[model samples]
Target: MKIPKIIHQIWSGIDGPLPQEFRSLGETWKRDYPDWEYRLWDNKKMVEFVKNEYPEYWFVYQKYPFNVQRWDAIRYLILEKIGGMYVDFDYESLQPMCEILENKTCCFSLEKEVGSNLFKVFNNAMMMSTPNHPFMQKIVKFVFSRTTLIPQYTNKNLTIFNTTGPYALIRLYETLTTEEKEDVYLIPAQFVSPFTGLEAEEVRLGVVNQKLDDCLDNAYAVHYYVSNWVKTNN
Candidate 1:
């Protein structure tokens, strides 16, 4: 089945107004993929989504150390239930995702590691799936199983990556059976993400980045790395 032409992005606004800078970035997605359905989510809608559609995860969702963690988890749940592309608000589109996602049942982008703290090869920032795909199903189960802190838990400092983000996805992905793995595509950087975190920041700060300008020449999408996750949570 082809990935549906629905796009999902979330901004908590819990932090106040959605930043002015990201508005133009979001416009790129709309411009590149015409006629696709877009769903923008906020803090309250996200909370209600879990309570209504995933009542079982209600307590776990509320107890998450940071709202960003919930942001990471809900994307998987949404994709699995309805099947669509869940792109981060910081992500910009150079072209429609239709071609890259045309043949895959589920897909993830290859992340360029820029720091020691970034511990995963894949980024959930740009993901696509068909409804009820096994890989997404597994992610839902994975998120729940590791959603809370236990005595054996590490990263007590609190990180979005390890707790419920891409690192958790990478961990579960490694255990997938050969058959299940076949249906999930790990797309290389050139197509979805080509810049390192440092480069993304450089571009955002208005520094001239010729290499990334070139990457945009080839990639269908670029994640601008507008970080919403706090390094530590209370």
Candidate 2:
């Protein structure tokens, strides 16, 4: 089956109103993918979703120590149940998603090394798949399995990454059977990512040497690395 034409984005709304610039970044997705369905989820909607569609995982979802972990978990469940695409708000759309996806039914954006992240190669920042895809099935299953396991990282970000972020996704993805890996595409970094987390910060700080336009010639989107998960205040 082909991937659905929908986009899912979430915000906790804990930081007062969603920032105007964030909305502008998201508007790029809307403008580029005019026909795609758009779904913006908040903390309450996310909680209600779990209580409704994934009641079995409610305890685990609530038990997550970090809000970012819950953010990571919901993307998987959203794609598993709703299918389509989950694009982080920081990922600015440069072109229509369909054109960039190139007819793939399932695709995960790949990133270059991310500091100390073990699974930096496969980023969940932008993901596309049909609903009920086999890979996503295993994704949610793996998420549930980690509910009781504790990663021993001293840094909170590392802990979240290891447990429910890209680390967990790639770890589970690698263990899938050959048949289960079928139709799952690992997209190259330059196509969508185009920068490491450090490099992204440089871009954000406006200190990068290379002209931004020079690097994005082939990019369909650019992840600004807003990284709300890294902030504790919220």
lDDT winner among the candidates?
2
lDDT of 1 at 229: 61
Report the lDDT of model 1 for residue 156.
Answer: 43
Model 1: lDDT equals 0.79
Q: In candidate 1, residue 135 scores what lDDT?
A: 85
TM-score of candidate 1 versus the correct structure, residues matched by position: 0.89
Q: What is the C-alpha lDDT of each candidate?
A: 0.79, 0.82
Q: Which stretches of candidate 2 lie over 4 Å from their true place?
A: 113-120, 146-151, 208-211
- Top of the candidates by TM-score: 2
Tell me the spans in candidate 1 whose CA falls farther than 4 Å from its real position.
113-120, 151-159, 231-234
Lowest lDDT block of 10, candidate 2: 112-121
Q: For candidate 1, write residues 1-234 as lDDT tens digits.
A: 388888888887776787777877888888987888888888888888888999998877877766777888899988998888888878888877676677888999987655664544887888999989988998888777643544335554335677677777888888988888888899877788878888888888888756767766678888877775644353
RMSD of each: 2.8, 2.6
**Cα lDDT tens digits for candidate 2, 69-183:** 8888899999999889899889898877566576677899988555675553787888998889888888888776645356588878777778878887878888878776767
